[model samples]
Target: MKIKSAVFVKGVVGPDQILNDGKHKIAFIGRSNVGKSSVINSLLGKKGLVKSSSTPGKTKEVNFFLVNDKIYFVDLPGYGFAKISMQAREKLRNLILWYLTSPEIEHSRIVLIIDAKVGPTKLDQEMIDVLKDFGHDFVVIANKSDKLKRNSRINQLKIIREQTGKEVILYSSKTTEGKNDVFSKIFE
Candidate 1:
């Protein structure tokens, strides 16, 4: 997709604050430091469009980015960061849940970003379960593919697919290998 105009919309903390204009929303979610922002930047064919950070829990609010003025690429806060307090984690979890299950959610599909090297964590599995419970099928992006060997990457992708029962795109934000694939699913 040729992104002629991709601009930051707004970051909201609650479901009620999500854009209610009836635009199709393709949301990105995962554990903290899983390269969610980087994946967004890669998909948009631009750098610094979504801020990438080394620290965990960099994104605290649900961010909305308007893409080509057609759909909204929602950048959600990541889960499962130990550095944050338990209260904060619970709040984030609740916010994520509300955004997923709430009827106001305009999400067409969610891109669940996972670390290619670390594979899916327990919390990641839990999120998958919640999505399934809501009858929402999501696309899984195994990010940071450049961190692992070719064989290991294949094995990890297989494992993730078997576990989630969903498509897992082999992705590297650094190389933008799976950038088009991600957008294809989103724009399909």
Candidate 2:
């Protein structure tokens, strides 16, 4: 889908009217610093649409962006390894869990971004389990794929696919690699 217009809708920390708006919601989630914002920007063909930062945990709330005036691309807070206090981290974690498990919100799709080179961590595994339990239709995106060598990339994708038991898309925000594939999946 061609993105003619995209704009920031709102950021919510908890339940809100926007969540029940009945728009097709596509949620983006990942570990801190996994380039969730970058992937969103690249996919939308907007460089600064989503705020990406050098420091991890820059996205504290569940931020929603309206894409094509039809769908809501939800940028959720990164789950792990943010340089924050234990209490703050727990709050963020709870917020994420609540959003994912909430019955009222019907997510059209959930994009789970992961570090291509690092593969899925223990936390990523936990998230996979949760998604399964909740019966959410989701996709695994291996971002930062430009950092991997060709041979290693193949092996890494295999490992990630095996671990997640889901088809893994090799993506690179820097090179726009796998952009069309991701776009099709997200909008499909």
Candidate 3:
């Protein structure tokens, strides 16, 4: 689907604030500093459309961006920001868990973002395990692929697919690599 317009809809910290107007919701989630915001901005064809930060944990609340007037691209809080206090981290963790497991979240497809160079961290694997335990399938995006050497890029992608047992897209938000594949999946 061609996106003529995309805009920020709302930012929700809990289930009560999640949009319930029946639009399809696609959410991006990953470790802190995993380029989740960059992917969202690139997919929408807008620079800085999603507030991204060089700081590891810039996105704290769940951000909802409306795409094509039919789907909501949800930007969730990044996990594994170790610089923060334990209390803050626990709060963010609870918020993420609540958002993921809540029935109030509707018509949602989860997109788990990974740093291509770093591969899947332990936290990433835990997230995958959680989703599997819950019987939810996710599309894994190996972001920051341009940072990897050409020879290692394919290997990383292979590893991600093998580990997740799901479709993996090698992506570079900077180069817009894998943008079409991601958008097609979102529209699907």
Candidate 4:
């Protein structure tokens, strides 16, 4: 699917603020600094379309972006950062959990991202477990594949599949690798 247009629709703080009215949506979820924004920009074929930050936990709110008016790429806030305050982290966690539980999101597919370099963490596994229990259709996408050796990348995918019981598409935002594959899955 061609990205005719992609725009940041809103930054939501709670479930009530999300504009979830039957539009197809796929969310990006991962730990902070996992290159979520970079992938979003790459998918849109625009530089800096979604704010990409070097610092972790920069995306504190749920960002919804409309793509081709056919689907919404929901950028949920990053989690599992160690430097943030406990209360603030709790709020972020609650916001994401609420959105995951929202009825409106029940119909949408989820694209759970894992940084290929770091592999999956405890938080990532927890999120996968939640998604599995929620009984939602989802796919794993291993981002930052450009940083790994080809063999290591393949091994990482195998490890992730063993841990989460889900297949993952390898991708790199820097080289536009796996861009078409991801979009095909999203539009399929």
| Best model per TM-score | 2
lDDT of each: 0.87, 0.92, 0.86, 0.82
For candidate 3, write residues 1-188 as lDDT tens digits: 78889999788886554557777888888998898888999988899889999988899888988888878888888899999999999998888887777766674688999898898899999999888877777888999988999899778988888887878888999998988898777556
Which model is ahead, 2 or 4, in terms of TM-score?
A: 2
Candidate 4: segments with Cα more than 4 A from true spot: 104-107
Q: Could you tell me which residue pairs clash in candidate 1? A: none
Per-residue lDDT of candidate 1, residues 73-172 (tens digit): 8888899989889999999888889888987677787889989888888999999999889988788889999998877877998988887788888999
At residue 184, give the lDDT of candidate 3: 74
Point out the worst 10-residue segment of candidate 1 by lDDT.
13-22
Question: Per model, how many backbone clashes are there?
Answer: 0, 0, 0, 0
Error of 4 at 144 (Å): 0.5
For candidate 4, what is the TM-score?
0.93
Each model's TM-score, in the order given? 0.95, 0.98, 0.95, 0.93
Which segments of model 3 are wrong by more than 4 Å? Answer: none
**What is the Cα-based lDDT of residue 81 in candidate 2?**
66
